[model samples]
Target: MSELEEAPPESGSLAELARKYGLRPAIARPRPGVYLRQLWERRHFILTYATSRNVSRYSGSALGQLWQVVTPLLNAAIYYVMFGLILGGSRHIDNYPAFLLTGMFVFTYTQRVVTSGAKSISGNLSLIRALHFPRASLPLAYTLQELQQLGVSMAVLVLIVMLTGELPTWSWLMVPVVLLLQTSFNVGAGLVMARLGASVRDLNQLLPFIMRTWLYASGVFFAIHDKVVVSAGLPEWVATVMYLNPGAAFIEWMRDLLIGSHDLPRTVWVACVFWAVFALIFGFWYFWRAEDRYGRG
Candidate 1:
């Protein structure tokens, strides 16, 4: 007989019985090689599954993908009224609507990743428990769905710009590069949230409010540069903290490309790229550390 079969029953627990002899727990050691290979072998399965989910989820509605455009337009209108008309802000920034919309678009991508990743494992608990594939794939597939949607949103923005007389410039070509960095940042944050929020459900609820604060502090709806540089009483540490925000780096880099006669320091672009890479590495490690636990309830 095998060592496990020959083991003596000890105490009341199966774990104790197994441990009393020489048997190890079944779930304790998953086949990492098989797990990774399963992910690669089922790439097509993942792609098709993710695509169908995106389509059915959005297309089931009456208006269909029209909500994509409607959602942002409504957001822009609200911000215009609150920050532009009532408070009479954005006077310091040129093409306020365009500026606000660009930042919102970028921020929305990250927000989607964070919120969705946070709920991915919990929402698909059955799949996680039953399936033997990499848990990382769950968060990754969710991020991919958002990326597809973001592409549609970007196309809408391009059309809006054309109608509003914002012609594409040579600098517009740099958009894809900036977008790549933004996506990297999202993937990183998404992966981290998947594990963190799975361990603690509270992270999911707290993320949105944190993101809203991040949005305002990012200088999307207003210019904080002059406030940072010229205000004599402002502490240097405060300005440094503002500069460290990844959203702020992304917004400033985007404005340099989108707005004419405006340019950001090279360091800003470097900062965005740096943080994007940083987030990706940190998030991947954080998520992977709990790989085995993810399948547990």
Candidate 2:
């Protein structure tokens, strides 16, 4: 047989040839440290991509980006009617409108970040396959975009809080602290969901139901303590478990800052810090574990 015919498989030879030439697989996953450095290097690209998405997100609508503020406000109104007034969820709460609005604004930030992050990869298949940048950038950009939208919603939240007779206090200074923690948790959560979403095509369909359930269970429209403790008569630990939920924890923390009548347990802040660190660490490792598989067919 000819030397070519007698040769081993081309695949093995090609791999050896690539190694000899300092080449790697097209989708080769980088080491964790390398991946993080790559992500940092592309930070500007991530920011610009996120900003473009925010600009285009509502470009077609007449109201444009105002919907960012209006969508949550409208949800607050609907929730107010259904749960606050009709269901009497606002009875125990002081400044029920502001309370409900605060919950929606805070929870919705995480909600949008997760939802968009899940779709970030699948929705941008072209980009993923066309480029070799860190896959984590997609989720990070989506989270930043949602944070931008939340900024508008936050201004409205403060105004409404004041209108409802909540005067600003020293507690308000903690707003950024709460937001920073929540954003950290969101980044990790988004990274995880991005990996899951790229693998599971059906996850997108279930997210809305999941988010709606989370919204109701999070005490977005009612006082978590009043409903879970006073009304449900569940054990203290049960209420604590609910308070420990990342979504509930952030919303309660924000409420404490923005609503004067809202008081929270010290454990809520602990939960916030714990979840932020845990999710970020776990999510990064988890998502990075499957990095090479992200854009595969």
Every candidate's lDDT: 0.77, 0.90
How does residue 230 of candidate 1 score in lDDT?
56
Q: Tens digits of per-residue lDDT for model 1 on 1-297?
A: 776586665557777767789897544534556656766887777677678778887677898867766787788889889987787677766777777787777777777788888988878889878866678788888888888888988887777655655778998999889889988888888888888878886886788798889888887676666556554467766666776688888878777787674558556788888988998888877777777787575
Best by TM-score: 2
Model 2 C-alpha lDDT per residue in residues 84-147, reported as the tens digit of each score: 8898888888889988888989998999999998998999999988888999999999999998
All candidates: TM-score: 0.85, 0.95
Stretch of 10 with least lDDT, candidate 1: 25-34
